[model samples]
Target: MAATPAWPPRSAPRLFVAGPLVQDAQVTIEGGQAHYLSKVMRVAPGDAVILCDDETGEWAGEVNSAGKRDVVLTLRERLRAREAVPDFWLCAALLKKPNFDLVLEKATELGVAMIQPLITRRCVADKLNAERAATIVTEAAEQCARTALPQVAAPVKLETLLRDWPESRALFFADETGGETAAAQFAAHSGPAALLVGPEGGFDEEERALIRAHPMARAITLGPRILRGETASIGATALWMAVSGDW
Candidate 1:
């Protein structure tokens, strides 16, 4: 007899649903998700799809219904439990569209818990498309095989972020001017932390002072050369994961 196929096919498509999911239940994929699976992926009935809810784990499901605008799936089994991501938040000043998109895509792949976009004096992109941003992260998580989607918060001012900052979580601010090296600093603090990356022109004098004075903040240097906004966010997150998170 032939061996049974893996519950979740190796090449099964992965998607992020909104809430809790259970085995032997039906789920629907609408809008862009539907378009991608039916049109782009060309999935048909019997083709497996891996479904993940941010609140729960992963499920092995097969396409039950497919349409031009919608596709329905029925869960066959639970594949894996929800993964424990690092307790890291990427609080970055907003850059231009292309650069900010890069940060969202890369940070999701790096497995950050949250993505907080901060509006500073030098921020060129004050407004963000929340729906589009969410799509970017969701797709990134699906592509990277991440079970949980990173929380993409609405844009907030730097001052507000500082004022309402959690006292327990450490905040690592990437300061080009002066601070300890990222490796040493991250190694020193392994608890819940957030990395703050400035915008294209960097933070202004006032903003820097406010961040430095914040009780939960720790100023750190990326390296000798000044990196771009997106680079700083990705590099700092990767370093933190290596030093303090699962490597």
Candidate 2:
């Protein structure tokens, strides 16, 4: 006889629910998730629904009931364990709203462990909508099939960021003017690391000097071209993942 196919097909809708997902446990999904199941996907009883608890990895579940306001499913088995993401963080300077949204989305897809929004003198925006940002990252993770969600931190001033920097992590500073090659520097480092990129107007002279003077800061350059704020963050992150991360 042929081997049985997977219980939940890859086409099944995936969601990240709160709390732990145990075997044969009932999971009640509400709000927009319910709408997505009942009204959108029209999931029926026994239909597979992939779920991640953000704590216990991914699980395969079957719909027990679908109501207008809620959908309940019984988890059958754990599909996979929580992924091991690279020990990389993106300490990016605040950019325009749309640009920053792209940053959050791509950063999540790129598997950043944490995102620290920086407030600099040249930053166009100093504040971040925490709820909205969280939603963007969650959606991005769902789309990318990432079981582990990156932590989104509140916006912090550059001075405070530098002051509270971890002693062991290497801070790769993407300086527009010039520095060591990014790919080379990333390949050389082996421990916890972070990338710091500037805003639209780039870092001010004082800010640049301060970052460069930090003991953990290793100035790096993307390439010959000077990338835009969003481009720099996204591109540099991709490059880092390919070089030093779990690509």
Candidate 3:
């Protein structure tokens, strides 16, 4: 006889449900999720879908029923434990909405533990729709097969962020004017760390001085060329992960 399809097939579609998955538990997929499974994926009973609760890690689930508006699933066995993401945060200065959204999405995929949005002098935007921002980050995590979702904190002013900076966490500020090299600094540091990126026009002189004066802030340069807000944010994060994170 042929092998039993390897429990949940590797090709099975994956989803993150609000779950505390237990063996033999049932989950009813509703709203857009249901629509996607039924209408888009066209999953039928007995087909498999990988499910992650963000708390219980990955699980094997079999479709029980594919209704018009909902899809029911039965959890079988645990496939893997929740991912161990590094304690890395991306505290980036806010850019325009679209650019910010791109940073949020990419940060999730790049395995940031959290996103702390900062309001700087040259920032184009001041506020974030919390729910919408969470949705974007969640979708990015799910699409990229990240078991843990990155927390997208609301935007805070640059001064407030600096004032409340955690002493235990190293704040690697991506200063356009430059200080220490990015790779060297990342290699030298360990434990809870965050990368601070500037906005479109870059931080004003006063803001830079304030950040520089902060005890936890370590000024780091990307390169000779000045990069845009989103580019700097993502590029700095990728470099950090390569050196200090679980790359």
Candidate 4:
């Protein structure tokens, strides 16, 4: 006899629910999610929905009932455990709205553990819409099939971040002025680490001095080409993931 196929097909719609996906438990989704299921996906009863509760992990569920304003799902089995996100953080200076938005999306897809938006003297934007940023990351996680979601922190000034820096995490500063090789430095460190990139105008002289003087700060070089703020951040993150992240 032929073996049975998977319950939630590969093409099944996936979502990240609000955690604690207990076995055999039913969940009720509402608001935007409810609208998405009913109106957008048109998910009916007995439809398979792959769910990922950031806390519990991936699960295969079936839509038990669908209503105009709510959709109840019954979880059948856990598909996979929550991902083992490496101890990595991206302390990126805020760029223009569109550019920073790209950073959030790609950073989530690239598997960074946390995102710390920074404000520098050269920054064009000092504030971040936390709610909008969260949505972008969540959607990116869903698209990339990420089991874990990176925390989107409130925007802070560069100096504030440095002052509260944790000793255990190595800080890799993307110095346009240049220092150690990028990949080489990443390969040298393990455990908790962070990559800090500058804004459109790049880090100011004083800012650079402060960062470089920090005991935890190690300068990184992205070859000879000076990339735009968003490019540098995303590119460097990808390199870090390849060299030191969960590649």
Query: What are the per-model numbers of colliding residue pairs?
Result: 0, 0, 0, 0
Q: What TM-scores do the predictions have?
A: 0.94, 0.97, 0.97, 0.96
Model 2 residue 189 CA deviation (Å) reads: 0.7
Per-residue lDDT tens digits for candidate 2, residues 151-223, read: 9999999999999999999999999999999999999889999999999999999999999999999999999
**Model 3, range 1-247, lDDT digits (tens) per residue?**
8756676776788888998898889999999999988998899999999898889898889999999989999998898899999899999988888999999999999999999999888888889999889889878987898999998888999999988888999999999998899999999998999999989999999999999999999999999999998999899889988897478
The segments of candidate 4 whose C-alpha lies over 4 angstroms from its true place after superposition are 1-4
Better of 1 and 2 by TM-score: 2
For 1-247, candidate 4 gives per-residue lDDT tens digits of: 9989867888788888897899899999999988998899999999988899899899988999989989999999998999998788999999999999999999999999999999999999989999899999999999999999999999999899999999898999999998999999989888899999999999989999999999999998999999999998899899989987478
Candidate 3 vs candidate 4: the TM-score winner is 3
Candidate 2 residue 223 Cα shift, in angstroms, is 0.6
Give lDDT: candidate 1, residue 198.
94
Stretches > 4 Å off in candidate 3: 1-4
Index of the highest-lDDT prediction = 2
Supply candidate 3's per-residue lDDT for 154: 81
**Predicted candidate 1, C-alpha RMSD:** 1.5
Weakest ten-residue segment in model 2 by summed lDDT: 238-247
TM-score winner among the candidates?
2
Each prediction's whole-model lDDT (CA): 0.91, 0.94, 0.90, 0.92
**Candidates 2 and 3 compared by TM-score, better number:** 2
